[model samples]
Target: MNKRLLAIIAAIGATTIYGINHTVAKGIMPHYVQPYGFIILRVLGAAILFWLISPLGPKEKIDPKDYLRMIVCAFLGMGLNMLVFFKGLSLSTPINSAVLITTTPIIVLVLSAVILKEKISSRKILGIGIGLFGALGLILYGSEVRQDAPNIPMGNFLIFLNSIFYGSYLVVVKALITKYHPFTFMKWLFSLGVLICLPFGLEEFMQIEWSSLPFEAYRGIAFVILGTTFCTYLFNIFALTQLKASTLSAFVYVQPLVGIGYAIFTGQDNLTLIKIVAACFVLVGVYLASRKPNRFYQKLK
Candidate 1:
């Protein structure tokens, strides 16, 4: 199969895992493992897995200049992205987190325009606006007083912060994706992520009562380490080589669908008409935003 198809599949797979993670991770946090502790587990486990496989890939060395860039990717993608997201998910409903994550594509578009100086067509701008409206609509109407989610507003805000940092990470890492093997970059990126996040997570990590935890909690933790972190990040970084950052980020639109489905399946959330409509807007907006410009428009220009 062509790399493009493979990249598209990778993007979809990564987002699907992330969508499910909203509920799975929520099932374990603030009880079995707090958010910070879970971040530590995710980064550390994924980092080790990347390191273990790095030697199997090409043995190219990273350029010294790119080291700084790698560090920034780690800080934004691995550290800030996961830390805030899990914290927010802990305090927000899975469905709400799912909807807010759909904003990532818009953030990516803005970052791409500003940092990469990528030109945006009027159609894409309209798509971005429509997507933003849907995302904000979800944030406003989706807020609920749940037993597990205590602070919907604050949690949603933090999740939005995560989207910004994650969007910036995609733009920042695009240049480096072609320079090194995915495993090589990931090993270093997550190593730095662990170091940077250690201070905040250590206390929480220490609080885990490993022996007393139930089997289900263990399964949730393992799913986060193996499925959510190791597999998803690897898939996304690999896809970045074959697709534009905006194109890959557009897959975030799938997360809400995936997340809401999982939530509904598990009897954790109820569906609503407003959510259905908001999802429609986001899906249509992402399609328009990620599409290649029309040939007629190019010719007319």
Candidate 2:
């Protein structure tokens, strides 16, 4: 199999986990475990897993300067990304969260141009505008008050911030992705993740009443720790080795479809005409943004 094909699969797999995660992780929050506390569990569990498997990858030493970049990556990707996302998800519906996250690719495209000096064609810019419009429409107009979602507006804002943090992380981590094995990179990023998340999450982490929680709650927690955090991050880093950050982030377009499907299948959410239209906009925008140039154009360039 081609490495780039495998990377696409990896990126798809990561988004699939994330799609399910909107509901799976939400199933455990506030009632069973608070969001910040859940962040601690995810970071700690993934960090441990990364370290345990680190020996399987080729041994490599990090350049001293790269450690700083790694820390920033950890802070953005693992710490703030997980922190704000979970907190926001807890206060928002699964469908809304799913739809808004598609903003990541646009953010990634912009950041890549600014930081990496990557060129953006006019088509991509138009796609970004259309996608942003759809996302913002959903954020502003799609409001359904649920018992679970306490503050949809604030939650949506935080989720948007989470996308920004995650988009920035993609660009930052791209610098280091090819320099080390996935295990080596993940181990250190997650290790620093534990430290960066500790202060904000510790008090909430201490508040959990462990023994009294139900099996479903435990299942949710386990899914987050193992399926969402560990596997998704691992898959994404591997994909990064073969795909550009913009390409990888473009897979976020799949999240809402998968997320809404899972949400509907599980009776957690309902579909609306607005949502369907927004999903179309997002899908088309992603296609336009991620499309490759013709062979002639490629050769000319």
Candidate 3:
């Protein structure tokens, strides 16, 4: 019970931080630079934060195979995934971006089953069907649903790819995490990520025109560092010690509602009858996907 409580608190904290970051980033993205440029900075910021804040401990040795997997994890988790997401966020509205990314859980389910041999259950299929219907409805009904808006469509699609890469990274890392401390795991992940992202980051950095924007534009980068980049994942790390990833997956969806509330607060968006219905569907889906059939439920009298 205590563990569950702690996990809930951590997940809530993570979601709140993530929610705020989305709002913050939405405000700053177009003001400063392009998505690729923002992501280069975001990942580098996370790299620095993880290194400085991470603790030193006795190291656990692992196979070369594990190290290779960590490299792939870095590419998918930090490098490519972030690049796509930030770019997408820059092009699309924050609400649209958030809604698209919610597909991460579904991706995780499919990837885990194929790669990790985890079984797909009936409840997961039903939850996905319900949630996807709601999400897909919104996508189709969005103000500019046509692909003619290249930036918006591109951004939204990239976020979906972001979900896939992120989900796959989780399955990949699950093998190595038990053998390593979180800090140690992060060290390898970030270090490898820095190199993989260098090619893209370098291109972005070179193309940026520092003179075009005032120093204030850099504020978004800092927000990415402190509010969104560092804090949200730290909250997730805290929760991992207490809860199963499945439970935490459901909690991740809470960020969408958090995002909707942000939009309302900022006057950027208001809850519509349709969106309310969509939110309810997403909530129910997350609830169903997060839970496994309990032994008590199975053995019901």
lDDT of each: 0.82, 0.82, 0.69
The sequence of per-residue lDDT tens digits that candidate 1 reaches over residues 1-301 is: 9999999999999989989998999888787899999999989998899899998898888899888898899889999998999999898878877887877766777777786577888899998888777777766766676788888778877888898999888778877876777778888888999999899899999999999999999999999999988888778768877887657655766788899999999987777787778777777776677666332221111
Pairs of residues clashing in candidate 1? none
Stretches of candidate 2 off by over 4 Å are 1-12, 235-251, 293-301
lDDT of 2 by residue, 1-301 (tens): 9999999999999989989999888778889999999999998999899899999999988999898899899989989998999999999878888888877767777777777677888998898778777777777766676899888777887888898999888777866876788788888888899899999999999999999999999988898889887888778868877987556655766888899999999987788777777777766775676566322212111
RMSD of each: 4.3, 4.0, 4.8
TM-score: the better of candidates 1 and 2: 2
Query: Which residue runs does candidate 1 get wrong by more than 4 Å?
Result: 1-12, 235-253, 293-301
Report the lDDT tens digits of candidate 3 across residue range 1-301. 5876977897898887776666677776655666666777777777777777666655655578687787888888888898888777776667776666667766666666676576667998787777677666555554453232246656666766788888777777666766777667776677777777778767766677887766656776687777687777777777877776556655666788788778679865555566577667756765575466332211110
Error of 1 at 6 (Å): 7.8
TM-score of each: 0.87, 0.88, 0.82
Q: 1 or 3, which is superior by lDDT?
A: 1
Q: List the residue pairs that clash in candidate 2.
A: none
